[model samples]
Target: MQRWKINLSVLWLGCFLVSAGMTMITPFLSLYLQEDLGVEGEHNIALWAGLIFASNFITSFFFQPLWGKLSDRYGRKMMLLRSGFGMSIVMVLMGFAAAPWQLLLLRMLNGVISGYIPAAVSLVSASTPKERMGFALGTVQSGSIAGTILGPLLGGLMADHFGYRPIFYITGGLLFLASTLSWIMVKEKFDKKAAALSAKTSMLGNLKKLMRIPQLPALFSVTFLIQFAMLSPMALIPLFVARLHGTSEDLAFWSGFVSAATGLSNMIAAPLLGKLSDRIGSFRILVICLLGAGIMFVPQAFASSVPELLVYRFLLGCFIGGLTPTVNSLIRRYTPDSSVSQAFGFNSSSLALGNMIGPITGGALSGLIGIEGIFIVSAASLLLTSLWTYRSLRRAGMGAEGRTG
Candidate 1:
């Protein structure tokens, strides 16, 4: 196999391992806190869970750019190892935690060290042929999406059988294995002198230079809005499922299905759309996916039954799946080779920013405007962002031409 193909395959597994480990604790965190850590009250357990969950993103959001800068100066491989190994250790320690505070601190530390996905992206983007970038990124993205979709189900099963602490230990062991595979298999044609020179440039200087790229800011906003809109309805999915299903006995199963439905379609659609983008234009795919996703959201808001909502969500996933790969492909096209890692790092920060805000905003919208309102707000946000992206592309003269200006 070709070197780029080899790297993509290995990194795909790495992405899946890291993403699954990160989310594997999701279904049982509250239960673990109450049972093992001795959190006394329901309110406190909920509060601790929220804090622990948000802590990772909060620290990750601020530190990703720093890691990106280092990746450019050193190599993406090193960053990947650092994140994978560091997270593995932290996850293991979480299993040993005797108190909620200890777990929270460890979770925060995990955030500070997190950058495996962005580093993998930077590594693949730097190595893949420009003509194949969209397809490669789309394929890579499917790995993470698949892991996320399966993590909760796996976690719930493992928690029921092996218990919570063993789940963490197993996840940590998987992370270690993933990192070891990358260390042995992946390769990068890095130039040390180029990295040193790039490192000499100030972070502010790099930012200023990157800001001059005509379509970069718009692309970044597209990433943020895509994440924000996609995640806004997630926190309330169970409640919404209950509303649609009434007192059905299969409510838990149906709710889990509704939650996983979008990711399932997204996993199937990402690579196909990516290949199409490689042939036609990522810009065209971006516009269509954004608009299509926005339109799909409206039907979801109005769905009268669980089946109706599931259908709409699956359709939305088909469009939404393409958004990130297209955005990453655009970012790689527009960014300088020497600074692509930093560029992706900043983009990763934007994603983390969305992760931080999306859940809070979703919860707030659910309380203030009701569950359907969250879908409407998300749809409207995506629609407006699509318009903004369209105008931005037109003004930059990249409309349909797909030139890497």
Candidate 2:
């Protein structure tokens, strides 16, 4: 096998481990707060869970660009290790948290060290051949997607059997092992002179340079909007499921199935779509996925049963799965090699911003417009984003076939 192929395989596993570790606590977070931390009331548990959940994104949003800049200077491998090991320690600490605030603070610290996925993406982007960028990224993405899909299920099971704290310890250990593997196995051919030269440029200078790239700013917006549209309906999914099923008894099982359905399809579709993008062009795939996902959301809003909603969500996932890998490929195409990590860092921040905003916006709007309205709003937002992306690509001189002008 080729060296890059080996690197990609190892990195794919590392991404899975890190992504799984990051989400393993999610399923039982509120339960942890109540049973372990002595928190009282559903309202209080919800409030604390929201705070804990958002804390990681809030800190990660501010820190991702900084880490990206550092990755460009120090090397992507270093950043990966920093995030992997740092997050492992934090996850372990969470198992020992004595209060809700303690857990929140630890989560914030995890965010400070939470650039592993983007770092891994940047590393692969920098290392892989330009022609194969989409397929490579798409393949790597499936690892993370699979991990995310499985993490909650595993966490819930472990929590039921071994309890929440033990799950945290297991997650932490897995992360540490992942970091060690990356340190030992993954290889990056770093150009120190180039890195030093890139390092001399200020973060503001890097931002300015990145913005000057045609279609990049718009691509970043696409990143934000894609995440926003996807996450907006997440919080209300269980409620929607319950409404459709008309029962509380099987709500958890059905809700979990609905949530995992998209990811399951995404895992299967991302690499295939990615290979197609490699042939046709990443930008073209981006447009198609965005528009297709928007249209998929429409049927979801009107689904008469949980099974119908599940089918719509699965289709949406097939399209949405292509969005990030294609966007990353496009970013790699437009960005200079020396500063690619920094560029990806900014892109990560855009994604984090979307994550932070999407749920809050969805929750707020759901109150006024209702749960079905959330899906409609999400569909409209995605459709508008697709238009924005099209115009931006045109202005950047990328043709309908995805060639740069």
lDDT winner: 1
After superposing candidate 1 on the true structure, give the runs of residues whose Cα lies further than 4 Å from its correct spot.
1-12, 26-52, 71-78, 93-104, 120-142, 159-166, 180-199, 242-256, 275-280, 302-306, 333-339, 400-405
Query: Positional deviation of 141 in candidate 2, in angstroms?
Result: 4.6
Q: Per-residue CA lDDT of candidate 1, range 1-405, in tens?
A: 999999999999999988888877765676678678998754455456656766788899888778877888889999999999999899899999999889989988999999999899889999999999989997897788878887766776677677779988999999999999999999999997887865256777877888899888888878888988876666566567767889745554566567677878888898899999988899988988999999999988889998999899899999988899899998998788988866876787788788767765775556468778889999999999889999997787678465442
Predicted candidate 2 versus true structure: per-residue lDDT over 1-405, tens digit per residue: 877787799889988887777766655665577678998854455556656766788899888778867888889999999999999899999889999899989989998889898889888988899998988997888788778887766665676678778888999999999899889988899987887876266778888989998778988888999988987776566567767989645444566567778888888898799899878888888888999999999988889999999899889989988999899988888789987877887887899888877766775676578779889999999999989888878788766548631
Instruction: Give the clashing pairs for model 2.
Output: none
Q: What is the lDDT of residue 376 in candidate 1?
A: 94
Poorest lDDT segment (10 consecutive residues) of candidate 1: 41-50
- Tell me the TM-score of each prediction against the true structure: 0.77, 0.79
Q: Give the Å shift of residue 249 in candidate 1.
A: 7.1
TM-score of 2: 0.79
How far does residue 109 in candidate 1 sit from its true spot (Å)? Answer: 1.9
What are the per-model numbers of colliding residue pairs? 0, 0
Instruction: Please give the range of 10 consecutive residues that has the lowest summed lDDT in model 2.
Output: 41-50
